[model samples]
Target: MRIGILGAGRMADALGTQWARAGHELMVSGRAPEKAAALAERIGPAARVGTFREAATFGDAVLLAIRDDGVQDVLAAAGAADGTLQGRVLVDCTNPVVPEKLTLKTAGGPSMAERVAAATRAHVVKAFNLCHEDVWRMTPPVFDGVKLAVPLCGDDPDALALVRTLVTGLGCEPIDGGALERAALLEATAAFMIGLWFSGANAQAVIPPLKYAFGAH
Candidate 1:
């Protein structure tokens, strides 16, 4: 698969390296041309650097790994290529959570993914927003002998499947998170988890086991 990543940051580097090792062609782009080139060099020969517009136009699927506030700018740069992102499967990995309080910046309006979907004709899927980028760097981020389950919210089945393949390539499982409208819930989950994590709380302990929660245990 040809994968284009919109940022040269940690999220882009971690995921791009994994996908590149899995034999996928990678195109990395960022606001800084040197950084993008450096990332591509580190990812090896199969990976290359390009402008935001070139990256956006170069792949079968595109990962928008830019910061929450930078998504619109990247999209604008990409859309300038052909005037639209129609027929593209866009993966959104941004979180609108504030740094200190870990509260959602988009508490009253559209979630980050929804805003991206609304801004373009691309089929947007929300995913990978609930964990730190370093978590993605793990060879297989399993804990307690369970592969991490990544929730994906999208309306397009094809786009979902494509992203699921990418998720599995990182040795993670992709769990259906229902329709696109549910993306806000995932963003909220990120904010909640981040708050708990930063507060030195065991966020996982807050959730009962599935069987117990279902009253079947």
Candidate 2:
């Protein structure tokens, strides 16, 4: 698959490297040309650098990996509001949280994913926002013999399917996280988990095993 990545930051580097290794073609773009070039180089021949607009239109699916605050400006520069991203599969990995406070910027409104969808008019999928960059950099992201599970939320079936394939390519399991309307929950969950992690708490311990979720009866 041809994938376009809209940032050259850690998330871009980690996920792009993994995807490139999975034999996907990549076009990486960012506000910093040098960073984009360096990331593309790190990913080898399967990757190349481009401008924001070029990356937006270069792939079967585009990964919006930029910072939450810069999303609107970047999308506008990529012609998203002008229909350049229309009908495309847009995977949103951004989390709208104010890291210092570990609170959501959305403030009980639409999620970052929904905002992106409104801007791009694309088939948007909310995913890859739950973990840190290092987790994605892991070869398979397994823990105690259990593969990491990536939850995805999207309204479009085809778009979700494509994202699920990408998740599988990372040697992780894909979990259906319901429709796009439910993405706010995921974003909130991210904020909560991040806060827990920052406080040196094991967020995973808060959730019981699947078999115990509804009682062992």
Global fold similarity of model 1 (TM-score): 0.96
Clashing pairs in 1: none
Tens-place lDDT digits, model 2, residues 1-217:
9999999999999999999999999999999999899999999999999999999999899999989999999999899877999999999999999978999999778999999999899999999999999999999999999999999999999999999999999999999999998999999999999999999998889999999999789
Off by over 4 Å in 1: 80-82
In terms of TM-score, the best-performing candidate is: 2
TM-score between candidate 2 and the true structure? 0.98
Per-residue accuracy of model 1 over 66-167 as CA lDDT, tens digit each:
888887788888873355567699999999888878888899888888888888778999998888889999999999998999999999999999999999
Looking at model 2, the pairs that clash are none
